[model samples]
Target: MHRNHELYEYLMKNSWQMTEDWYKQVDDPDPNSLYSTTDEHIINTLKEQNQDYFKRLHKIFIEQEEVFLKEFEEWTIELAKDQKHLDTAVHYVVREFNKTQEVYISYLQKFYKENQDKVKLEQFFLWLEIVRKTFQLSIYIYMEEAQKNTSKQIAAQKEMINELSSPVIMLQNNVGLLPLIGDIDTARAKLILENTLTQCASLDVQYLCIDLSGVAIIDTMVAHEIFQLINALKLLGITSTLSGIRPEIAQTAIQLGLDFNSVRTTASLANSLAAFNQ
Candidate 1:
């Protein structure tokens, strides 16, 4: 009890110098790291944030574990959301975080040496436990935030790829051409249906030339979904023409009792478009 109070007082007195030294040690002015930014205002803000963290960390020794954890969680949540840390690798921050543990350990060891009678052996173990728990929470928050950010990025990229792959070219006024050039998985097929309908409506395409020249194969479910798109366009007062149906794919559709009699189809995209408005 007495050792805790004395150590708290000693830490409070040395907090400013400790914070400054810690900042100096971790400071990476290489312009690559989020903290060691070149901008004067950014550098100052990072320094302030670093100092605040050190102050709060030292207070953990004096405060209740629950209270400190609540505050630390809040601080780290902000750190996780910060664009600076998001731009940098978590491993970089991990390296810097390790330095802090080393620095504080050195401080604890020095305190133990000078006041051997005042500091109990239990205090060292207890302090290590607190540091370990706090870092565990920090690591969890960083990983969770990074994972969420990566998921969002991947979703955005997928959406972009869907849009690019299923392009509706304005081959003529009131006429559009959607050329499916790659493998049509179930997901991409669904995207094609949605994008086709949306683009047809938004672009005011009276007729859509769906060219499947690039597609070598498709499943029955995929062929059904595509025909469903055609049916949908028909209800919308729009005409849809299927072109460049590969022999194997057409046979698969026929074998599945799929009929193209209800919809117009051509052997080639050029022939389909050439027959447009004639």
Candidate 2:
């Protein structure tokens, strides 16, 4: 513990230089990195964060060596859950964090070289163990938190796409137009059903014209989902018309044994809109 305090005192006094060197490396980073594009405010915030960390770290290392990991935990979690860091690419952050680790190891080596008489072998091991464990734990939490944030962003994007793809435009009083384009998969088909119904209710649509002119093909299940969507609309008291269903989709609907005889359909969007006037 005596040697631990000796190393700690040395590090406490040199923490500012160590932190400054870490930031110097982080500033220029890799050429293709997000760090290169980061704003000045964020850079300043990062510097302040590092300064706070070093203050806490120095005190813990010198006064309560056994509690270093616990003392460092809040700082680790703050970095992990931080929106700015989470928004940056994971690989870029990892590269910079590894560089910071290198800075520490180098600082320790420099310390040993200048003060060989003050350092013991076991003291070196204690320093190494604490640095390695604390930083590794921080890295693990950072990666896990970033992955979770990414997953949430992806899910939110998919939902926005679904809402955008299925749109109901009001053509007249109590009438709406829904134009569906692209290939229909099970997931997309489900979105179409949900969004169309919600839009109809929101628009107070009594009749809806569904145009599928851009759809080239759809599987059997997708066809069934569309047919089911028509029936569902009927329950909501909305008159639904289908148009521009390609021949392949028709065949697939037939193969699925779907009964659409009662559902209204037209050859094109023009014809469907014309039928509305009559």
Candidate 3:
């Protein structure tokens, strides 16, 4: 139900040729990129994907624009999420997209030249606009999905780091050590609370020695979170002993009116360990 049926058929029939032509021109010197891969299987698969992409692109000339775009976007999103493409630098992938668009435009021009008597210059320009817009939409969708996947991976990595940073290492039967170091932001404090509780419960720790010797600063909110963690552990029947509480931290706790009298305290990790291990 399209006026450009002849052009659509022409492109569909030559999809493979377009893919081959596109790949032959690929000249990326970057050794880290999939574009420069020497693997035969990957090269073949890349050509297949490119051909499939062109086939879908040509459908826009024949199918309803809405239908074509919805299908095309799905393909682009899946390609964006592909590990090979994700591992490759984004700029390289986008450059390939630009090159592919040029292939389509070149093919369209060829078609126009062969049918100059039937295809007006204005009609050719209109088709060129459609080609450019479709490529733009595809690129936008790909970049958006790629960013979302990258963000998800980063968040997962950050969670892992938070978990590792707040580890509760078992030193003896029913005893564990949580060495607090560096800055304790509110976010990290909350993570510490959750991770500590889970680790303590899993390790069946009865006494947890929280060493704060390396920590140089603690804000009011973070200090509150630490207290909450202590109380939470208390509810779990785990006794928490504060060790190496720095002078500045103690001063902050005093200013905030925090009651550390309820929990046992030690001047250093060694003293706490000796007391708990005894």
Best by lDDT: 3
Decreasing TM-score order of the candidates: 3, 2, 1
1-278 per-residue lDDT for model 1 (tens digits):
32276776777777667666766786665567776666788767766776677777777777887788889878877777777777777777777677766666677777778888766778777777776777777678767877687678779999999889998888676889999998898888989999988988888899889999999888877887898889988988988899999998888877888777887899998899988857
1 versus 3: better TM-score goes to: 3
The TM-score leader among the candidates is 3
**Backbone clash numbers for all candidates listed:** 0, 0, 0
The models' CA-based lDDT, in order, is 0.79, 0.78, 0.91
lDDT per residue, candidate 2, 1-278, as tens digits? 53356666777788778878988876655555556757788677777777676667556456664576676775776676677676677887887778777877787778777877877767767777777766677678778877877788899998898889889999886778999888779999998999888888898988889898888887767877888888889999988899887787788778877676887999889888888878
Candidate number with the higher lDDT (1 or 2): 1
Clashes of 2: 0
lDDT of 3 by residue, 52-86 (tens): 99998988888887888889999999998998998
How well does model 2 score by local distance difference test? 0.78
Q: Model 2 reaches what TM-score against the true structure?
A: 0.84
| lDDT of model 2, residue 210 | 88
For candidate 3, what is the TM-score?
0.90
